[model samples]
Target: MTTGLLIVQILNGLQFGILLFLVAAGLTLVFGVMDFINLAHGVQYMLGAYLAVTFVGLTGSFVLGLVLALAAALVFGLALEFLVFRHLYERDHLDQVLATFGLILLLNQGVKMIWGAAPLSVPLPAFLTGNVALMDGILYPTYRFALIGSGLAVGALLWFIVEKTRTGMLLRAGASNAPMVSALGVDIRKLFMIVFAFGTMLAGFAGAMAAPILSVEPGMGDTVLILAFVVIVIGGIGSIRGAFVAALIVGLVDTLGRSFMNDLLRLFMSAPSARATGAALSSMLIYLLMAVVLFVRPEGLLPARGRT
Candidate 1:
């Protein structure tokens, strides 16, 4: 690959890493703090895109759609928390999996029923359309650049919240040992709700930001959901810091692997064979990375609690 192509791929990786970080941030918190396995979390992302499309269509304004969609996502998430997830706090992980898996089915069908089966995309705001030149001949989309900026800004904000704030300290405590924190009488249930809702918004925001770039459709979140899981596994659940680092790692690995795999393989074999093998292997790269991490550190890279 040319130097320019390499630069573009790096930028692409960074942008994608930011999005993964956003999604995984919530997933890790939900898993870590509440000790709940929420397989349905990805649906929140799908709903965010669908809601944005509907609201934007109705209001004829992207900003309005975003605001309304965020509100709707929070409301729906809270409803789910109250109606279903709340009851499972005391249940086993298997039950949480079964219930949340059912939720995935419900949500996928729900989106199809409301939005149809066809893929969709929200129009980018006029100002976001177009590209910018960086190095010699490389050009990147402005909207994607915006996404990177926004994601990093949010990452910084989240870091501050999780690392420096009082609520963050409580969350860390809860992640490490929820029973102990509850024993202190902090209304652990309320803390759970706050974490749940905030995480939902983060995942939803990722969906909304991605809608303009990625295909928006029923079950779209399913793939991203798996990726989010990979992120948390690699990062170490309950640690926002871990999620951030692992996300960037996965993003860079996935993006760069896909971009360069064919070329790398071509160096050793036939072009056609290299193309086919590289494509399949590239797709598995992140999972392989996750598995390797698990092998080395079963609890994850930066586990939430005391060292095992």
Candidate 2:
């Protein structure tokens, strides 16, 4: 590939990384802070996409649809917290996992029942159409550029909140030591509600952003959820900073490897053998990266509470 195309791939990798970070950010915090393992988090992502589809159909505006979808997701998350997740806070991780797994099944089936098994999507606004040339003869989609911009904006906002705000301070404390924070007389229940709702909103936002680019369907979140888990594990569980860094690493590695692995392998083997081997090798690259991270830093690069 030429230098220009390589630059575009790098840009593509960055954009993809930002998108992954958006989805994984909340997943990391929910597990890190509440000490709750939520497998159904993926369902939140799916619901966000579906809600956007429905709202766009009704209101016929992307901005209005986003507002409505976020509102619905916030409500749904709060309801789940009140009805189901609150009880799990005091329970063991195993129990939390089982309950959330059940939720995944229910939510997936519920989505199909309501929206049907066929895929759906909301259209991007006309303003987001077309592409801009960044370099000689190279153009990239406007929506993708917007995605990178929005994701970075959100990440910056999140960083500022976590680093500077009182609520962020409490959230960090909660993630570090929930029991200690509760002992300090803060309403831990309320704090959990805030965290849960915010995290759910982020995941939903990711889903909505992705709907225009990716196919909107039931179980779409499953693959991305697993990738998010891998991101957390590689970055260091419960650390937003770690999640961000890890996500970028995974995104670049996965994306670049897929595009270049065959070429790299062909140096050592014939084209047919390189194609077969490269495909498998490229697929394993992220997991291999995770394995190396674990071997070196078993607790992850940034453990939420500095606990190891």
Candidate 3:
């Protein structure tokens, strides 16, 4: 591939990775700290996009809609935590899985009923609707750049919160040993509530940010949920740094593999065969990478201090 195309692909990969990080960051925290299996977290992402669509439409301002949607998502996530998830916390993992899985189905259908099955789109803010050239004959969407920048800013903010703040200290402690933290009078329930709410907001923010580029529709979060799981598995559950690094790795591997597999393979095989194999192999790249990483470091790259 030419240099320009390669640069474009790399940018695309970073953008995709950023989105994954946003979702995985929250997922890993909830899973790592609370030790809760929230199969329905993806639903939160889907809800965010849908909420953005609704709010943006009503307010006719992208910034206002995004703010409103995030507020709503936080409220809804807390409500779910209060009414449903909190009780499941004391139960076994099986019960948590089953309950959350059921919530996934319920919410997916609920969205379908509320928003219809048709896909929706959010208009890009005018300022971000243009494209910036990487070089001659290559250009990237300004919005995607904004997405990447915003995601990185969030990552930094998250790092500060988790690494430099009292709340983050508690989160790390909770992840390391929730029972012990509770024994020390940390109010484990309140901590769990905070973690859950924060995670839901992160996932929702990812969805809202992605709405301008990705199709907004029913069950949109399911695929992302799976990817986010894979990300945490690779990044080391409970480690924000791991999530951020692994996300970029997964994003680059998947994007580059898909974009160049066919071209690379065509040198050694028939065009049609190359295309077939490339498509299949590209799809498997991230999982294969995960397997390789796990084989090398069972705890994952940059696992939380206690974990590694």
For residue 117, model 3's alpha carbon misses the true position, in angstroms, by 0.9
- Cα-based lDDT for every prediction: 0.90, 0.89, 0.94
lDDT of 3 by residue, 1-308 (tens): 89988999999999999999999999999988988989899999999999999999999999999999999999999999989999998899999999999999999999999999999999999878989988777889999999999999999999999989999999998888889999999999999999999999999999999999999999899999999988888988888999999999999999999999999999999999999999999999999999998899888888887754
TM-score, structure 2 vs. true: 0.97
Using alpha carbons, what is the TM-score of model 3?
0.98
Q: Write the per-residue lDDT of candidate 1 for residues 261-301, one digit (tens) a residue.
A: 99999999999999999999999999998999999999888
- lDDT score, residue 124, model 2? 83
Q: For candidate 3, what is the lDDT?
A: 0.94
Clashing pairs in 3: none
TM-score of each: 0.97, 0.97, 0.98
Candidate 1 weakest lDDT stretch, 10 residues: 299-308
Q: For model 1, what is the error of residue 305's alpha carbon versus the real structure, in angstroms, after optimal superposition?
A: 4.0
lDDT of 2 at 168: 93
What is candidate 2's lDDT per residue for 1-308, written digit by digit as tens? 78877778888888878878988899998888888889988899999999999998899999899889999998998899989999898999899999999999999999999999999978987889899898879898899899989999999999999889998999899887889999999888888888889899999999888888888999998988988998999988889999999889988998999888999999999999999999999999999999998999998877676555
lDDT of 1: 0.90
Root mean square deviation (Cα) for candidate 3: 1.0
